[model samples]
Target: MTKKGDQRQAEELDPRKQTILKAVVDDYVETAEPVGSESLLQRYPLGVKPATVRNEMATISDMGYLHQPHTSAGRAPTHRGYRYYVDRLAEPMNEDEARQIARRLAKTVESQPEMVTATLRMLSGITRYAAVATTARDQSLKLLKCVVTPLTRGRALMMCAFDNGSVDSHVVDLGSALSAQQMRRLNASIAKLVEGQQAAEVVALKLSLPVVEDRFLQDAIARTLRAAQSSARVATRGELYYEGILKMMEHVEFQRSLESLEQVLGALQDKHRVYDAMEQTPENELSVMVGEENPVPELQNCSMVVARYKAGKREGGVIGVVGPARMRYSETLPLVQQMARSLSGVLAKLIEE
Candidate 1:
């Protein structure tokens, strides 16, 4: 039988390999270039010969963790390499540092739009990579209140307030005029039924309510509820900051990668498509999809990092960043996590207010 110690060791990289891998990844991240054994030794005190490091790099390359560009003199980590580094080699943020980062993000961006824009800017600025922050689709919206006001003999305006403090208004046309008392009764009934339910649930409940004496009023209410339900469908907004676009032109792989990125951005612009992609991802998990692992072929040359942010008990959204496979995971991971947490906190407070 395999010993427990053996199993544990099998799950982890050998110390020498781990150190070399870390050194290589760190060097590539800083320089944004392929790393060689000579440079690795110069940057790290590994007490090893250049030839020995070169052999280890070859082993890593054979394992599909490193790739050599035709034009470059050395090797760069592949997406698989980045995955292993993130899952095992990277250090976790300390409690105090995490809190400080969270606080800084919270103080910097005060609104939803600001939060998204700031996140995209920061991701691009720090990583010198293209960045994206897409809003989550399929968020559940709760009704906080509803108000109905008669605008004409055969028309009325309905205003709905979501628990997230976003208000939607619609105008409904009735077949004929109704008395003020009849309007009051209809308003009271709708407010009571919709104040604590989702748009779909409200529509279902309204349909089951006892039909009033005036069929016209009942029809108007149904139409209004349907309009509200349609309006509540998931909507996505985002900011895509393409940093170092010119810098990418310096690499051959980027020639094809840039074209793919444009198509991906176009897909993101269609809110429904963005929602569909975000919903396919699981909640409360940091998802990383690289190269061909992406469902969208246009993303084949890119890597995406996604996480969800909740606004208190009701509203929520998703935040994500996109970059090349060789992007820096150690820095980007913490930054994204911190941004999501701070965004949730700010949105929760805004909705509460």
Candidate 2:
């Protein structure tokens, strides 16, 4: 989600202060160490006296941009500081990099799942952080086929297969015996009626049909609708895939123990939870939830950078990376957006195919 501007409205930063903020974030991201005014002066030609830089650092710290980790250690950018850097100061991804990413994806990806995996892998590899993609979107489910198979003398199973390659089946008690001819007619009727219909449309079942002479097949068709709806309800819970969890472990933030890493992964393992985080951010806008800004305590020490990617023309999915609060937002943010564009193209092509 885009950062809300009201938080920064209390006191508009001067141009010099913005430069200090950007320098501090850039240096910290590079070194993963606290940044001091002296280092800023040495690395950047700020044209400000050392004392003035120190004073401004204190002012920005008071404004919640920078924080001193220890009395002896230099100050570092707070979550608010990262927010300001992303919204106002981060550099755009140059065309050369974007074109390179396009060429790379075009050569390697050949299928929908491959494209999704490649995008998450690219994000994880480049950001050097845990990356996640929610691959199963419920809205993308469309009826591919519906069939009824006899289970016993008076019972059968109604099965519905969707475009996403998911199958859902429900047992139907026939009550009366269904002959082979009767079952064939019922399956043909259902296949014809649900040919291009969505799950909801299948459930509604507004189909023009000849009067069914077979009572058992009539009951079976009614039960098939229930089975499709059940599948639709089950699909609301999407599947989650994660990569580069070990990359996250290398960061100092997670080096103390494996507990933090475990907690973060456990929290993210739930597809619905991660999907909510992605959707909770502004639609079609890249969002950066830094450190304590994250709603879940497990992610309070980390950051979640996410955006939605279109799945063909009608459906969409979530993609994101998780790393320490001190992240290369300037580098990773644009890369994630780039990977999403490539993945969207792959999905659109699959839809066409």
TM-score winner among the candidates? 2
lDDT tens digits, residues 57-157, model 2?
99999998899999988889988888778778888899999988877776664666667777778778878999987754565468888787877877778
For candidate 2, give the lDDT of residue 178: 77
What is the C-alpha lDDT profile of model 1 across 1-353, one tens digit per residue? Answer: 00000111123467888888888888987777789999899989999899999998888787777789865579888766776777778765567876876676667636667666776566566666555555544335677787878888788887887776778787877556778887888787777667777755764664566577778778766766665555454311233323333333443456555675566556445555444454455667666665555555565566666677776775366666666666667777776677677777877877687
RMSD, one per candidate, in order:
11.1, 9.3
Scored against the true structure, residue 231 in model 1 reaches a CA lDDT of 47
RMSD to the native, candidate 1? 11.1
Worst 10 residues of 2 by lDDT: 1-10
lDDT for model 2, on a 0 to 1 scale?
A: 0.76
Clashing pairs in 1: none
Q: TM-score of each candidate? A: 0.60, 0.71
